[model samples]
Target: VDGEAKVGWPTPSKKLELYSKTMADWGWPEYAAPAFIRSHIHWEDLDLAAGERVLVPTFRIPTLIHTRSANAKWLNEISHHHPLWIHPEDCEKLGIETNGLVRINTGIGHFVIHAWRTEGIRPGVVAASHHMGRWRLGDDKGRSWGAGKAEIDRDAEGRWHLSRGEQQPYESADPDTGRIWWRDTGVHQNLTFPVQPDPISGMHCWLQKVRVEAAHPGDNYGDVMVDTDKSHQLYKEWLAMTRPGPGPENLRRPLWFARPVKPLATAYVYESGGTTG
Candidate 1:
């Protein structure tokens, strides 16, 4: 971390990379270096449903890091809810009062959550810090102060229906069980998001443009409803958007990129027309 400017960065060339040949070779010369890849959630790309808009799912509060800190009782106490943050103007436009329950519909599923109207966010944008909405399902009776449990039921044809169960009060070794403070166990909105894999990075496009509508009759907090069939449908849809499947792209991720360790040279031998492993 010290005095490496003169020696160069720990890259293949030991020089800071402005242009990534790996990206160029992989078909995205535009992003081979530093350049803005317009976010997937722009107004032009979105076909919003009534009362819906773009969602900023990565927003985080000072108290936690994504869903990992949910078990930290103190941290959870400080930040227990991932309220749907909206601009006050947009909230009015959508008829959503602060703390009002709203249903967010993703491409794959939908979840109900409380709206939080504030001037802090941009108009037409709904931000939900993803870390807070943690739940447990099936036979798992109580809120894990951290993890989740679910209630699972099967029908005549063996189709399954899963729903969120209450965080039951239970006697536990930790005295805090009796005093578990905040009960706003958030929704598992992540389930609702369909996989939008990036053609270059091999990652899900997490920033989603979704529709946020007023809660209809029978919507509840911590509610998540997914149609696995629909999810798979979207999966295939986005899968077709990728450039090429993962494998050695002429060379795997550019041998120059700094990694904790390197693989053998033979590992990078995937030919142009060969199957990607």
Candidate 2:
């Protein structure tokens, strides 16, 4: 028999064949190898041009520190701000001046961010960390503490009033430790990626091969369209299907309604049990 003859059905062997066949059907030739083997194509083989494709390693929002801990307040108070890190060279090529707002577009999607030029990043790429946008929960007067409350104003005439007051940023508190923190300081990279695969390997590569352009002055990057309604519907359906079942109820009550079960007892005793003076 040929060296490639079919072997007994092992789980790993079967998985490998299944993956290879799936890639073949999807037009991905580079990912047909066994899972245990390292078959990452060399960077040179991809013929990537400078500023064409880049690798971005992202982390969680710093305010939350971890996936489960982000909802806390104290963490957001100290260091939970988010910003996009971009190489100065890349900023220059896209006509994006330092610290200017720029839009990044890929074959599948796009996003806008305020550019931060840093030499620490590789020359050809940009990195946008996540978790900066947050709705303010009424707390303080400053823009960093929580979204400030909006008020309506009217002129001498009794016309309807509409005005958006500046928002105080959100401050997160750690549920377990009661520590307060800031939210904008965190890094959220997932927002910049797309749900696409590499053509050769069929490996899910979230980062996009895209271009950057300077956004018009006074333009807010968040206003750009990232996904269509159809795509959003698909994503919603997928989320509903994959989310875990609800867990136990939250037993901790809000601070305002807490009550002690019993009253404190006070004891008064003289030097002697009787009046011994």
Candidate 3:
């Protein structure tokens, strides 16, 4: 039955279309066909130094949700630490041990985490899971299953620092709290990354070209430092890359593109010579 039948896609022409009419009509003919566009952390654009490596920070562990499984005791016990996954070759070249501490420097800040050498990751690239790293300003606040206590402060230069405190066994209504076996809640590396949205997709790009070096003096396992001022500047830089909308017929967005929730047809049309609210 399968050999006798033929099937095609749902779009017009009933086949895969490399050229997109929607993109051409929306004033983006250059992107009508599939093509590679250089990104903020593109390898050629990064020109990484000896110690610098591209960090793929948005990868997720199969067992956990995106930063939401911290409240689950079983999941926390299964995977507690979100260690920096470095390729074995790169780790050896940089003289990094399996459990050695490494500081990853981003555009606006740096995060200190433990390096775990593994062949599962690609050479010259490092990865860290988005799970874990849940923290509360004080020990009394937040859930105890996967969150740790941290002290945050701002210096004279407007730099924010988050220093993690030890997670000690505490007496609570839940007896499991007293049997806590792990001290590390991982490092909150996302706080150090700046917003870098893709121009066309508008999705935040999570990959970053960062310098990975031995942890500096006084650097703790979960240390995270950021400069909000610089982060804001980066936000503007990416925002500037976007092309103005109000395409043909003064439509705010391409009518063919799917949105989370479809709005009224009138909402798609912007006022003459004015942007939509």
Candidate 4:
């Protein structure tokens, strides 16, 4: 059966042109559709990088909240850690088993994560999602469940006492619903990615061109690479703005006088640093 086209909707070619012009105006000529269409980089263009290897990270299902979700009864049952999804054929060559740990490396960075061998991905490429590896949840110093402990001192009478230490627990409440959720925390992937700007779009391309290797069990998945040079530059800029300098320059005289007083009489005496005679 043929489906009817919706009214007021632009044709595919027109839509493509609109997108191309919009992106071009935003300084993304390289990402313009005309260039992509000519180069045959369509939805099915995964294997288009044939004979050449590339690594891409995809986002995990919404239900899972990185490695932290593993502690939750509901989300853990679904899937907690991010596993690298690789083609079955690639697994055979590398002798990698499904659910085994592997080290994914790129020219700029690398991380050790679990591997999920499946036919869902294209060969010669590996895919991983951001989020996982929460260690502080169970640690004594970490506040995975609720607030930290407070110290209190009691007298012999046990009636009254002074409290010495007070530490608030890490708390997160949804702004819209007002429901709270807790977990020992960590920063997101944006911190790990370099601040290098794309030449054409002037946008930060967080995804890096990468490589992968097998990693043993119990490896630290939280470790990630960061561009220290960019971090240092950011720190210097922040320091300059915050440091204090000169105070205000101009001062204005009061316009009105109080009861039984004159404004001009006080102004002249103060300016000359003299006392009234």
Candidate 5:
């Protein structure tokens, strides 16, 4: 350690190494230096139709945290509807006016929501803020930060339809329920999204791309259309990316990565070589 040269960032050298010798030594010279790998969701690759755009799903508003804050009425009031943020230029190109409806089709399913044309977001990208739409089946009489409730129905034909009717003044210890305003409580679009597993980072990617379109007839605000069967199929496809065995590395798990409960060091070696410890 005393003789080791101090290095600053860019890895594998005393100074920033433009060419990573470590990667070259590892037989990946092409990726030894900085490189550009086009994203799978790049606009050029997609066979987009007239109204179709690409979705950028990770954007979030400051008013709320993830899914947990949905029941927080005050926070919901600050930012309620998770409108699909489209660019003004794109709206003109697609004939989609501000606050107009846009149907987003994912690999698994689709959902319809109002579009908000803004310059903050770029064209060719549609972003919906995270976690505004919290719903339960009509039977679950639970109340939360959300201002309204919804009804999800599956007819004999096996098609799923989601709709949120008008919220009536209700009696509750929380007076906020009576004063509850705003009709666009948003839709549960998560069900329509397909799982995207990252090939490089080895993390399950929540931000995914979806194909967008002009809302079809009967598509209303908070209206979501999805095929659960296709969702399962897409899940299977992503799961298929996983290796059959333990891992790419011989170790059970990476030592540095955070785990809720850490196991014995010996267990990390996997003496038995089965799934369990």
Candidate 6:
């Protein structure tokens, strides 16, 4: 029996390897070493004078799942509004008062929402929980638990606009729908966000760099404006940052890596004249 301690990790070195040889052998050599890779919204990339702030959209309320469980009236009542969690300092700097309208301008569009100035959030950074702010175009009471009635329109400039109204009590199969007291269903902020996938990991980056300011005179409480064309352009830009597959061994991806729905071994191989499944 070996006398040495067997408490080491299961890694190749039997200990934490700061320099990952596995990554270097793979397509991502740049990530082989622990390094701080700058994000798309790096601090240096933002213009502080322009009211630019990083939007942390991945925050979630402990009482709610990610936009789910809306049918639970109790949960909806507790975590109803997904307001912009801004620092009081930033609010004062931007002239945004508590519960005041703030327009968050993303690359593709902007969403008008109420601002909650609290020290719980970091300065120069803002957050909006993922729960709530659901909307439906018509009177589809199917998801009426936390969803509000919204009017969607496209302008001549090919920009999409969604204006959500306050949630009103309505007659539904659930008797509780009629007794609904909370009218603030929150604003749909996702519509104004653009898809920013990480190049190396292929994960969606939820932190968005945006301009935060007081709402314009015409901006409504739940107003959302998106330019589909601009969104497409930004998508293409981020797509170009990624490295195409066919990594080591001519495989679409590392065979050891886990996939949601694993296909056949043949499907993982790169076929020059074939399209993705």
> Which candidate leads in lDDT?
6
Tell me the tens digit of each residue's lDDT in model 6 across 83-149: 8999999998899999999999999999999999999998989998878788887776455778888
What's the distance in Å from true for residue 163, model 2? 16
RMSD for all candidates, in order, please.
Answer: 4.0, 20.5, 3.4, 19.1, 4.4, 2.9
> How well is each residue in 1-277 modelled by candidate 4, as lDDT tens digits?
1687644334334342445554443334566664433211123443322222345554667876545554454453344345677888877766678877665544334455557888888877666665543333232454332222323233454322211122223334523112323322222233333444433323454554444566645444434444455555644543443212111121122222133665564342345333221
After superposing candidate 1 on the true structure, give the runs of residues whose Cα lies further than 4 Å from its correct spot: 1-6, 33-36, 47-49, 138-143, 147-149, 152-162, 245-250, 260-273
Question: Candidate 2, residues 1-277: lDDT per residue as tens digits?
Answer: 4778666554433433555443433333455555543222323433233335453534444455343334444555554444557777767666667767666654434445567788877765556544444333234532343232333333454322222233333343523322323223322234434544433323565544556667655544443333444345534543443212111121111112224652222212222333210
Question: Each prediction's Cα lDDT score?
Answer: 0.72, 0.44, 0.84, 0.45, 0.69, 0.85
Q: Tell me the lDDT of model 2 at 244.
A: 29
In terms of TM-score, the best-performing candidate is: 6
How well is each residue in 103-148 modelled by candidate 1, as lDDT tens digits? 8888867878889888888887888887866666534354567554
Which has the better lDDT: candidate 2, or candidate 3? 3
Off by over 4 Å in 6: 1-16, 259-264, 273-277
lDDT of 3: 0.84
Candidate 4, residue 136: lDDT? 33
lDDT of 5 by residue, 139-251 (tens): 33766556357787886767688887654546678888778776556667777776666543347677556767778888877777677778778777767654443332445
lDDT value, residue 13 of candidate 5: 48
The model with the greater TM-score, 4 or 5, is: 5
Q: How big is the positional error of residue 73 in model 1, measured in Å on the Cα after superposition?
A: 2.0
**Candidate no. 6 TM-score:** 0.90
TM-score of each: 0.82, 0.46, 0.88, 0.45, 0.78, 0.90
Name every residue pair that clashes in candidate 6: none
